[model samples]
Target: MGHPAEVEVLSKALSGIGVDEKSLVSILTQSHHEHKRTIKRGCSQFFVEDERHFERWNDDAIKTLKAEFKRFKALHFMK
Candidate 1:
């Protein structure tokens, strides 16, 4: 549950109908590298389904886009 509050905020930002880009940027940009790594690791615990599950999204294009962006941010910033 690494950084549960941060993880919850991130989960909220990525869940539901739309993304909270402001929240995402605020968290990712302000967090330390180690914190980002914790968040990245937490994502696996939270989103246990599968990364490719995002591609199966057909009901909402925005959701798919949001999910893909989430993946991108995780990969790009977690370094």
Candidate 2:
């Protein structure tokens, strides 16, 4: 629960019908690695009960978007 507001925003963005890539990028790119780790931890702790529950939150579109974002981030960080 480092940045509660950010965790909330991310939860909202990731929970719904569409993925808010802008907000995700904004918070993630602006955050330090420690902050990102905290946010990730907070998300699982607060928003998601467990891995199975979290998987239920993802539809096909969200899954694809998530994978794409991961790829993009990896490439961006590599540069």
Candidate 3:
């Protein structure tokens, strides 16, 4: 399980990268640890402690992540 605050941070970060809330929720609920790890890694890679870091990611990176997130959502939903 993840802390609510951490989850909120992840949600905001995901949205910043173009993921929808429903997909975010599904990912968080179904594969909590993997999702948490991905978010943490993304945050660290982008130095994302808040919205500002989200804003700073290059457009290409954001686009790549959006694609990766879509794949994650599909895999998660299949389970």
The whole-model C-alpha lDDT of candidate 3 against the native structure comes to 0.60
lDDT for model 2 comes to: 0.70
The 10-residue segment with the lowest total lDDT in model 1: 54-63
Residue 1 C-alpha lDDT in model 2 = 26
TM-score of each: 0.55, 0.56, 0.32
What residue pairs are clashing in model 1? none
What range of 10 consecutive residues in model 2 has the weakest lDDT sum?
49-58
Please say which candidate is ahead in TM-score: 2 or 3.
2
Q: lDDT of all predictions, in order shown?
A: 0.70, 0.70, 0.60
Total clashes, candidate 1? Answer: 0
Give the Cα-based TM-score of candidate 3 against the true structure. Answer: 0.32
Rank list by TM-score: 2, 1, 3
Instruction: Sort all candidates by lDDT, best to worst.
Output: 1, 2, 3
Question: Which candidate number has the best TM-score?
Answer: 2
Instruction: For candidate 1, write residues 1-79 as lDDT tens digits.
Output: 2478988898788777766777878988888888887997765533333466552323354457567687778876999
Count the clashes in each prediction: 0, 0, 0
Instruction: Kindly list the per-residue Cα lDDT of model 3 for residues 1-79, writing each as its tens digit.
Output: 4455655656565655455656556656766666576665545454434465443545665676779777878988999
**Residue 5 of model 1, lDDT score:** 91
Give the per-residue lDDT of model 2 (tens digit) for 1-79.
Answer: 2589998888776665656778877898899889988997766633333565543332554566677678667877999
